[model samples]
Target chain A: MSLSARRIIPGLGLFVLMTVVAVWALWPTGGKVTINDRARDLAAELRCPDCEGLNVADSTTTSARSIRKDLLRRLKAGEDEAEIKNSYANRYGESILLNPDGGGLGILVWGLPVLLLVLGGVGITIAIMSRSRSTRLTPTESDREEVKKARGK
Target chain B: MKYSARWIALSVGAVVVGLGVVLAMQVGNDPRIDATKSQLVGQPAPELSLRALDGTAVDTNTLLGKAVIVNFWNSWCIPCRNELPALKEFANRYRDDPGVALVGIVRDDSTRAIKAYVKAEGIDWVIVTDPDSRAALDFATRGQPETFALDANGLITGAQIGPTTLRDLESLLGSAQGR
Candidate 1:
């Protein structure tokens, strides 16, 4: 084999191995989805009606326990998750869900942080790149004079 | 500063200030549930088939022509105790009126304690036990002392949280339509 091909082959193999490992690690498990698992997952997203700042899964309040049990029963009865969640949101208010709806005012609540993060990242990158460029500029006559004066002092 | 750095700083500052202003505007954002604005309002009250303390089967499905006042309370709650007099007065006022119905569901309390309290307080209204807190869950109650008034059509007309005064109860009853 050619020297360039020999050098590139191991790096390509390593990259392919990394890509496979990453895909396998990030892929969701294909295990059986049980009613209990669905119920618990939904419960984690629902707010506890009687408690302060606690979701149904974490709260030990009677209302939380009752809701969790009700979720399991609903799931077992072949009701879809959206049907159950909508029923809850209808009975209670929209605040019952830990995460707000994706539409309407929920868009602002979920989108603002990400937008701000991107803007901030762009600003930082620009600042850093410009700083590097500025540092590379050669010293002018005035700059040398100032440096000499400082050195003399 | 370089031109790019200055622009970046200005934009960042502007965004930070904008975010601050937006957040500052929400300083008065109330997280607590609004008492006057229950989601159940204008919706039919959930069907009830619960057992009362005195072995009476209190089924709301049977009370079609009467307005229902479902009050969720517990003996341990101070607000529940505070609102007892208003409720008792309401029960006395509506004793002979078949057009109205009052049902008090116990929340997170024992039957023994409720029975004792009912006996001592002379609570003649339909006092029911919420097994597994089913009624509370059905009603979507936040806590004790939350009351809901349903009109004769089984539509929830008014809902109130916290200790309610006699005047408040009267206003709630007045709001119930379709009677």
Candidate 2:
């Protein structure tokens, strides 16, 4: 194969891989009526209102059981996962969500660390480049001796 | 230039510490950072029709013209027990008030336990059971001892997430009235 073909083939493979991953993440598992897999996955994402820091799927509390039942009902009703999540969020304010919304203050909480990391990377890159350039212009021993004698060292 | 870089670092550190302190102060004042606040306030209360501990069906629609106090509690909850005396007193105070109704919802508990508690506590108000917790879920309760005050049109006027005193219940009930 030609060089360009070889490079393009790998690039195409990477693009296809990324597309599959993205689609997998956004795929709707909400309409699945199985009581265990999809329903339980969705339940696990919901906060158990009566239990402290426990997800609905994990809690044995009656309230959690009810919530799980409600979730299954909605799923069986053919509601989309996002729709079910939004329904709870609307009734409970955004705080009820185990995962915060992508908008508003949640964006800040999620974005700040990534922003700091990128900025730190740029700073480190600049520092390394400047240090390397200065080292490349290193003075000879004669030059150092001349400077030392001039300074009466 | 080196001194300036150090100064910038120091300033950034100071700002971070200052922000942390401000957040710390707020943490004490607002411990419900993870708790869901009432989104039902000012919204029409969801339909609640459940079997009372007395085996009678109690529905919110029948009490449409009356100010309603819907309290969600369970027999097992300590906070629910703690607020029972205040809740009882509030119920008695409003017992003669035909314009107001106080309804308590027992969550995730048996009728036998509730009946025993109600008799022992002398609770003379309407206490209902949320069999599947549909009403509690609709109300978006975080924990037990949550209370919601609704106006005559069945619109929620106020909501309390924790145990409330008689004064608070009175204020919540009063606000729902004449509105």
Task: Tell me, per candidate, how large a share of the native contacts it keeps.
Answer: 0.54, 0.48
> How displaced is residue A133 in candidate 2, in Å?
16
| Model 2 C-alpha lDDT per residue in residues A73-117, reported as the tens digit of each score | 888888978999999878876666788677854565676667556
**Worst ten in a row by lDDT for model 1 chain B:** B29-38
Q: Report the poorest 10 consecutive residues by lDDT, candidate 2 chain B.
A: B28-37
Highest-TM-score candidate: 1
Number of the predicted model whose lDDT against the real structure is largest: 1
User: Which stretches of model 1 miss by more than 4 angstroms?
Assistant: A1-33, A120-153, B1-11, B33-37, B177-179
| Per-residue C-alpha lDDT of model 2 across residues B50-129, encoded as one tens digit per residue | 98776888887788999999898988889998988899888878889999898999866788888898898888899888
lDDT tens string, model 1, B32-91? 454235778888888888898978798867667787788999988999999999999998
A81, model 2: CA deviation in Å? 1.2
Give the residue spans of candidate 2 off by over 4 A: A1-36, A108-153, B1-36
lDDT (Cα) of model 1: 0.84
TM-score for candidate 2, residues paired by index? 0.69
